[model samples]
Target: MVGRSVTAVCLAAAVSGAAAWAGTQTQLPRAKALAFGGRPVAAQRHRQRQPSARPGVGVSMNVHEHHHDSGERYYGPASKPILDAVKSPADMKRLNLSELKQLANELRWETLEAVSKTGGHLGSSLGVIELTVALHYVYAAPEDRIVWDVSHQVYPHKILTGRRHRMHTLRQSGGISGFAKRSESEYDCFGAGHSSTSISAALGMSVGK
Candidate 1:
């Protein structure tokens, strides 16, 4: 009877120990899965939680990287057929008012994008986009010699007058001048940074002409 009771107690203890070992084996895999799987699962959940229709409007992710390309990434209106066709003021003359309007919008956006990347006078460049387009449309540039007063406003002018390709090089070392340079292009009849100097230069050009 004593031997049988000892045997029964040993059997129960062994069964409990085996059960506990089996439970530990099952729990380890679950714990590892939770540890490893949680990150990607959470990332996927976050992505799914985001609104598909307006993905960028309110999201506080890194946007500057997406907004403009770095260093000759080719984000501009010059790629458009209309803008591409406009190699010079002569090309601009061929476009109708409607096309010119479209060109102005494209040019404005392009200038804005370029300036945003290259870091220059954005407000001044944007302000004169219409004027630049209209002037090129109406007058014969290089011959008529459209003189920009504070030549920072000449970004659109530069684009219109066969310098669209080199726009990325604005104000860089050994690149195109930010202000007008007579040697740079004939369209730039006078180069002046100051407002007062532009008038005198324009007057000199008018008198010389």
Candidate 2:
């Protein structure tokens, strides 16, 4: 909390990027929610900051070394056609509600196996699976910019748009980034890491026009 003459700044970090994707970030005023103590109006927002370069790979665990099951049916580059077939919001939109559940399932298993090997932000990314799918289903990528705050949750986003096969190479010294990288993806609108800042950046883009 940052306390000034009249107001206080509170910082919150939600692990759900899926919720962020749902276009459900609206909220009531803080003044109305909190009990007021004599003070001034505080200007508060999440400021994007450079991420602390966390070193060290995940401690290798061989909990299931005895039996390895690699029998997985995966779509190859053929998925590119399916991805290309999905262009606009109307195209990606789910005609059936069941697809959200299916997307969630796919994201979970993929995330677990990937992060199990790579060991990044496992919990947050797993939690937001539904939200990510919903957003992709609703918004047209490369055109409707989606800025991810605290970019960890973006792994699944990367996977769905066509990075599924790269799970084994995640976070390597010279591999796919653990966060958004312009070189890695065109889907990433603005790369960021911090508690929050997406809305502000989007506002700037809006004002740029």
Worst 10 contiguous positions by lDDT, candidate 1: 1-10
- What are the lDDT scores of the predictions, listed in order? 0.62, 0.55
* TM of each candidate vs. truth: 0.62, 0.57
lDDT by residue for model 1 (76-130), tens: 4445677878888898877876677777767876786667667888757765666
TM-score of 1: 0.62
- Give me the candidate number with maximum lDDT: 1
lDDT of 2 by residue, 1-209 (tens): 01111111011333254355434432213332221221112211111132334665333311211111434222212223433443333555753555455445556566766786777887567656666667667566666666776678778778876777776788988778888777788777667675466666666666665
Q: After superposition, how far is residue 185 of candidate 1 from its true place, in Å?
A: 0.6
